[model samples]
Target: MSTNARLQANPRIDAIEQVCSKELLAQTAPHDTAPPGLSETRSDGPLSSADDVEQYGLSWETRAALEHSHCRLSLESQSGHSAHRTSMDRETSDTDGNTYPEGGLEAWLVVFGSWAGLFAALGLVNTIGTFQTYLETHQLKEYGYRSTGWIFGMYAFLTFFCGVQIGPIFDAKGPRFLVFAGSVLVVVQMITLGFCTQYWHFMLVIGVTGGLGASLIFTPAISAIGHFFNEKRGVATGIAATGGSVGGIIFPLILEKLFPLIGFSWATRVVGLICLILVLLACLLVKSRLPKKPASKENVLPDFRIFREPKFALTTAGIFFIEWGLFVPISYISSYALAHGVSSQFSYQILAVLNAGSFFGRWIPGYVADSLGHYNTLIATVALCLVCNACLWLPAGDSVPVLVVYCIIFGFASGSNISLAPVCISQLCKVENYGRYYATSYTIVSFGTLTGIPIAGEILSQCNGEYWGVVTFATCC
Candidate 1:
């Protein structure tokens, strides 16, 4: 029907009272232009007058929304109506999940929770190279690079893979239990990691425990933010994602300092303690704005069937390739530096520098995505990643400055792979089913994470320890 009729009948406007500040709404339409039809008795009548809107006991948010939708409906009628109507209809349909508070004290609290959880979750994913490098030298010294790769590869694998189930759970149950369980598991992973000495120990304790915890924490963390914001989602998601970069920088620097003094056991324990605090914040503050859907036979299981949609399928493929290229650097930069005769201190510090650039990468691209198309921003950043790998990293062997340049540039470009991917995925699906679509895409992409690191290591081995093979594989992909 007409946008005006749909706007009034829409149940979503009822939620406006919960989200909009009445004072803010009162300011949006200061002057009254009351039409004859609206009255104190009318609830969902056509807003005949702006003055009548205030008199109907409608919320300021609802009144303002009616006014705005009415104006847009008028403009579309004046212009070409069909195409605009179709687009507007699809966007505003309740099933598509467009209405969100977008801003409020409660919403920002969810953002804070997401940020803190990502710090503990993705921050460590970003720091895998540091972990890989250290374990190669110390704990897993007997293992080849290819073998050691499996431990961390599996860790990254489970991080995203588990989202297949977790995403659906988040949709049905909200984020409370998932965030809590994830927090406890990750803390245990870090604390127990300090005591690991064997290959199997690292595999079971870290590879399994850490990976699952990361998935549990991040899937809900990212999904919850979607419930509260829409127009600013790109920037907001980017802001939350910077928590990973923040964690990446801090964890490395802390480990760099503490590992030397306190040793691995105590050093890891320290990191665990810090994650405990952050994850606790996530547990307490992170919440879903949407009411939970009761479990259903149809909705309980994740529908992998969504990939039948071409747009979603293509988007998933795009992310799979971009992410395939992305993690190679994150998981191996420190090792690449050390192999080139970079000092031990600089090698450890380099991952921190990559993460430093990533901090800006996460925020800036997200801000830009709100203005530019989210997919447009993601595509550009992906291209940037390809160029950096080929031009800078492929040539720089033992050239500290070039390696530094590569780290900074690549780190920045790759940052959006995590932050913007969700925004891109959300655009293609109904908002209510966002977590499912997001998890499904990343569930496919997660296989790339599972396989990408080991393939790089194998490539490294086949090239007789040359860095170019792995770099070339990542660039070409």
Candidate 2:
């Protein structure tokens, strides 16, 4: 049969072509273009304009191209565009058609920048144990564990809670100013932290200033990656998150050696210098994919309505428990070791060992989550953390070998909780609203961060210096 005969024979195929032409013209026209061939009298009827037929070219060659089965299928797949609309829809869809445009090099660089930024920011979070351990023995020695816990708790609280406001700000302003400002705050905190001799001083410098700096840098650093990749988001995000683990590894080792050599002040200054360099790279390379939204007071504020989604509410609860328990070991493992007669050097190194394992933990699981679902992977990791806390940390007594093992295993397992939670939240919302969702969720979770350490400290105090109470509280909480 002739090609025209085939198209004319199939009424459904003719209807599709007519619909495509009308939709294309409607989209291309400045105002609603009148339906191609309809008068007001038959406006509701199907269009059949000579202009449409002429524009589409009813020539033998054009008909042949449209009639070819392969060509027809290709044309149908690309039905919406008329070779003029170049803007690819990067928006997330309920349908599974969303994809990234610039695949390899560009996406990878964004991931790299995110990793570097996370390393400098989250690295400090992971090493909280080292700071807690050192401070408890030196500057804050007069205060009980419960009293000192407030400082770290506040730090963690600000690190996350501040993101609520910062997320919205990031979406409106882009990351450049936020990241640069954050870098400055972090450098200032590190430089000043060493000079802190009193409890209030530590709270002011590390808890408030340091926490704010971290939140500023961290929200934008991580969020910018979503602008670049969709399919490989898990792997890319994971690769970026490993920076925290790397920082965890490096910071502790540096602190351990530097503490003895130049005293705490100079040691922190050196670390601050390192963070300065890394953060500069992050500021330069890390960027948003979407144009900055116009800023307004309304847009900058977080909307709590997202909790209307049941899955997000449950996920938030899960994260709350995870964060609540997370800081215990980081804040106390060194103190536990020191109290148990382990040398100071080994005690600090324990944090490094955990972070070293975490470096791998961040990357490997991210690769896995790409194939497996992000939430599925996160749930499994959370379960693993519960096991590590229950089995390894619970039984770790005065034995160096046992404590060391616990640190490495728990460090790796918990690393996923830090890195994957944002991705899981991203999965729940549109890519554009990711900053809002992430900010809102963590704002609530920040309360957990604020009090988790102090509560653990109280548990320690209640147990008359025995760590079992603190460990049990950490496990249960």
Candidate 3:
């Protein structure tokens, strides 16, 4: 049958056309004329008016679905470019038949929740340098750089790697229980950190507990934002991500000041108390917009078959390389500063400076990405990271001025590495399945996070504690 005949034969399509006849006509009204039979709708005949639409006895949800589909198809056909629809076209209703509020009180509340949760989880991730420096000088002083690196590496590893299961769980069950559980683990990790004096104690609390809690919080927080946005997804995610940078900035400074005044134990407890408040807000506010699907074998399992898509595979690889070296600076900048004869005070403060720059980097690039394109913006930032590492960091030696500049430039460039990766992943799959795809990609990228720090630490040891090799390593990554 012809296309028109087939459409007419489908009862659902025929009903949709009839119910949405007026709306369809109004949408296409800008044309010089309507379709052949639409002008005769004033008369008593089929597809005549809203009265005929009501005669089909369709539910409001069904009518709404058909109306959107028919109108969208009609417009695309009129433009004669349906095959080449732009990203802007996809913005309207990109996933299944669901509609987004885009912005409303409830939607923005979700963003706030994500921001608060990330502030607590990623704040700690970003402050790893401060933690490393302190532990190296005191708790783990007897351990070699290579041995100490594994503790932090394990923390970073579980942070992203655990997303393999968390992502699918978020897709099936939503964020409520996940966020609650993650919050409890994180609070416990921070509270217990003060009491850690042994290598195994640090490993169990900071590495295992911290990593698992962070994974649960951030994965769902980022995934939930995708449910409420498409066209604006980049910026919304960026805004939420800034919470981590903010936490990075404040937490480090707080620890630095409190370390001597209050000692390590109470300082960590204070930070834990702050985390308690932030995570409580997240638990109360962060929510999933998508309806929960049934927990089933097919839905809950991780699907590696998505690698069959060449674009997705390439994206994953790019993220892997980026992540491989991304944490090196966050893990070592303080140590690098102290080794170069910078004041101990300034060494700790430099991390705050980097995170300060990151605060702007997260949201600004996100806003620009919405217009210039997510991939375009990500490429530009990654290239900037390369320049900062090679030209500024590698050559700075003991120059504080140059090192400060490197910190700012590199921090800004790397900030998008976190915010944009999820948005990019969402582009490859429907928003509903975003958690699965995002989790799977990060699951692969997790190995990079696991290895990057230890590899840098080994390079540090191999070069007799020199940082040039590590800087060069980051530049190449």
Q: For residues 214-253, what per-residue lDDT tens digits would candidate 3 score against the true structure?
A: 9999999999998888788999999999999999999999
Candidate 3 scores a C-alpha RMSD against the true structure in Å of: 9.7
Question: lDDT tens string, model 1, 1-477?
Answer: 543454455344533422332333344433474333322223454334345445745565665574455544554554454574764443322355357766667888888999999999988888898889999999898898899888888998899888888888888888899999999999999999987899999999888999999999999999888887788889889999999999999999888889889999999999999999999999999898677888885665889889899999999999888877778988889999999999999899999999999999999999999999999999999999999999999999999999999999998999987889999999887777888899988899988888899999999999898988999989977
Kindly give the number of clashing pairs for every candidate. 3, 2, 0
lDDT of 2 by residue, 3-112 (tens): 44545665766666656545544444445444344322234455454444455434445444444544455454556543322334432333444445434566677778
Q: Give the TM-scores of the predictions, in the order they appear.
A: 0.81, 0.80, 0.82
lDDT of all the models against the reference? 0.84, 0.80, 0.88
Which of 2 and 3 is the better model by lDDT?
3
Model 1 sits at a Cα RMSD from the real structure of 11.0
TM-score of 2: 0.80
- The candidate that achieves the highest TM-score relative to the unseen native structure: 3
Candidate 1 Cα deviation (angstroms), residue 84: 30
